[model samples]
Structures are given as structure tokens and as C-alpha cells.
Target: MENVTGLVEGEETTAGEAEFYDRLRPLVASYCRTPRIERVAVIGNEPLGSSEERAAMVDSADLVFRVNGFRVDELGSERAVGRRAEVVVFNRGVRPTPWFFAGYPERLYLMIEPGRLLWENPKLPEFWPQDLGIVTMPNREVVLPLGKALGADPRAGGQWATTGTVMLWIATRLFPDAHIDAAGFSFVDAPGQTSWNHAYGDPSAVGVEHRIDLESVLVRRWIDSGRIAYHR
Candidate 1:
């Protein structure tokens, strides 16, 4: 893999190209252990309608993954969304909440900046912790192939995969043997819906950068193929 420097612009001391791959190697090994991960949960930010059993299942998974701006305690009840987040995947542009950084050191953070493939530099948010190491997915290695698989036309304008889809893709690739469960993902069902119903904040409109129609098709294919088990 080629090295891309300056993950956070103007902050030269933080881990750049070398550190990213260094961290990724061990992280992959840790999850892809012998006997394999029994169950892996990829929790979306959408509300779970306070289903206690569903939330419990998410918490019980061997690995629980969450996306940007996820809320656990703030949700007030474990029924809305589980309280376990071992891995957090976010887009480079996301401005995560304070609670999102609560247990910063312990969680595995992966930033997906597909723009980096175009030689674009990433600038971290002011709230980003300086000590945190950045483990970014290689655009050519992960993003491009994934985009192609989902029918993305790189030649087209502003067509990119959402962070949630990227997280699911990563989980499937890394833990091939584990049974993957996805919860709170309502986009596929309502591709025409403009706003997002999150577990934490008010509803926000979908961004122009993402093509929900394209993602919905891919996700539906995954569900039908039994690659991942979907939960409301």
C-alpha cells in the first residue's frame, strides 16, 4: 500500500502514512483470530424503536461497530441502541459529538476518506483529540473496489458510498466467518425519504454526496444473499 501523509493538515507530529498501516495490521489480526468471531454487530445511528431484545443482541455480539455521531447513554435506554462500541467508522468530514470521544483510547477508530484517492488532504475537526492515532482505509484497496461493486461510477459527479455502508463492507471483509447483524438501518426501506432518523439528534436531511438508491440496491442484494442478517 502507498503511503498518504498529513491525515490532519498542519499537525505534522501525528501518525501519518506509516502509522496507519502499522495499526491496521494488528487490528486485522486481532479480529481475524482462530475460531473466528462468532457474531459481529454493525449498529447504525437510526432509532431502534426501543426494542430491548434487539439492543441486547447488539451488546452481546463479539464485536460491535458504530458510525459517526452515535449516542449510547444519551439515548437514555439500552433498548434504543446498545452500549457497546468497539469500533467506530466515520467519514473525514464528520464532526462527532463529545460522547463519541468518551472512551477514545480504547476504541478502534477508522476514518474513510475516499477523496484521498484523488490526492486530497484530510483536515481533522477541532474537537478531534491530538493523541488519537488515525487508521484510514486505503482508497484503492477498499473504497474503489467497493464503489465499483455497488455500481458507482467514479467518472460521475458526487457519487460516494456512505460511512455506514463502508463499515458493513469492512466487517464483511475482515470477519468473513462471523455472522454479521445490522440494526437501525432504515434507508433501504425508504430510499425516497429525505431526512435521517437518528437515535441521538433531530432528523437531518440526506446529503447530496450519497446516492441512497445505489446503496439500497447493494444492501438489498447482501440481505438476499445471506451475507448479512438485517434487523429493523
Candidate 2:
């Protein structure tokens, strides 16, 4: 565990880095004690047909996990996409907007891609959430090797797993006893289309690189084995 200052990208360390890590360490320890739950929902931002039954099913889960740039507002939201998130995962490349923290007020954990965030956010540790229960890192050392082993493309210099894929993996590891459910994730685009990017931006809008086909293959395997209950 390197210090947060060294882990995040920036020429100079910000004042908040030390204090934030100081508070973060103890909180992370406590978060590990979270009681086992029967179900955990991992939400993606893919398009879905709105259904009250689906929404109620997601809402009924004991814990919910959402990835970057998801909507929790009432207006124009589907019932299947619940309003609450117990844990939120973020990509390092995307800076945490005000809405990111706002949507997870009761956050039990704030999972982040530290190395990527450091490279992407040149400002380093500025404008971060201080009140979250715990800050967890999905380190590249863990992500890259595991993703490669799971058929992720190695051509991108080992950075290929999307946030949804990472979230799925995390849910399995963290809540082994819980039934993992996922929604809003369809790895392929429409017929005769290129890769289907997430709901947050236009296709190829960001510099982040990933192999959607490989991720889709892996996800499909997980679905087949009943590891992930994907909302079709």
C-alpha cells in the first residue's frame, strides 16, 4: 500500500491527501465488517425497457452497486433502476462530478480505480468526497492479470476491463454469499453497429480503451453459469 499521494497522479501532493488517507484507512477496516447480505445489485447504465416489476426486484435487494455516471433521479428513470446505491464504483479517468457523490449519500464504500484516476485527473486528490464510509481501490495489478486470464484483450497494454466488468468481479469477490444481480448491461450494439458504449457519453467519446467483445464473452459465460443474474 503506497501512500495515496504517491498513488494518485500529480506533480505535487495536495494537503488533503494525507488527511483523507488517514480517515480512509480506519473506515476501510470497518467496512470489511459489513454483514453478509442475501442479495446485491450491480447496476450498469445500458438502456432497459422500463418495468415496475423489474424496478421492484432491484429495489428489494439488500445491497446495491452502481457504476459511473448513473441516474438516480425520479424524472425519466425506470423502475428497474433503483434510487439507492450502497456502493458506487468509479473509473479513474472520470473525475467525480457533484452528482456522483450526491447519488450515494448513504454510501457504504467508494470503490475507485486509483492508477487510472491519477493519470486522468491531473489535479490529483482535489475535490474528493470526505464523508464516504470507505475508499476501496481496484488496483491494476489485480484487474489486469485477472482480466487477461478471463479473456480480456492484451493488445491495449493490459488496460481493458470496463467499469461494469470490474463491478461484476468485485461483487462476486466481496459478496460471495449474496446472489449477484446486474442490470443495464448489454455488451453488444444493435445489428450492424460498432461497440455499444455506456449511457454516459457518445461512442469513443473518451480516451479509455477496452475490448467490449472479450468482456461480453466473459460476461456471457458468467451468465451461463448462474454467477450473474443479468437483467435482459
If scored against the real structure, what TM-score would every candidate get? 0.82, 0.69
Candidate 2: C-alpha lDDT: 0.58
**1-232 in candidate 2: lDDT tens per residue?**
1111112112122354334444543442343324546677788877566678667767777777778776553557556476667677766445453446774455654555534523444333555656544455535433654455456543446456777777776666554446777788767333223555655555443234565667677766666666677676
Model 1 segments more than 4 A misplaced: 1-25, 28-36, 73-78, 117-121
Q: Which residue window of length 10 is worst by lDDT in model 1?
A: 2-11
Residue 85 C-alpha lDDT in model 2? 70
Model 2, residue 91: what's the lDDT?
Answer: 61
User: What digit string (tens of lDDT, one per residue) describes model 1 on residues 96-128?
Assistant: 766588887778888888766554577887778
lDDT of each: 0.72, 0.58
The residue-level lDDT of candidate 2 at 54 comes to 67
Please give the distance, in angstroms, between residue 45's alpha carbon in candidate 1 and its true position after superposition: 1.0
RMSD in Å for all candidates: 9.1, 10.0
Best by TM-score: 1
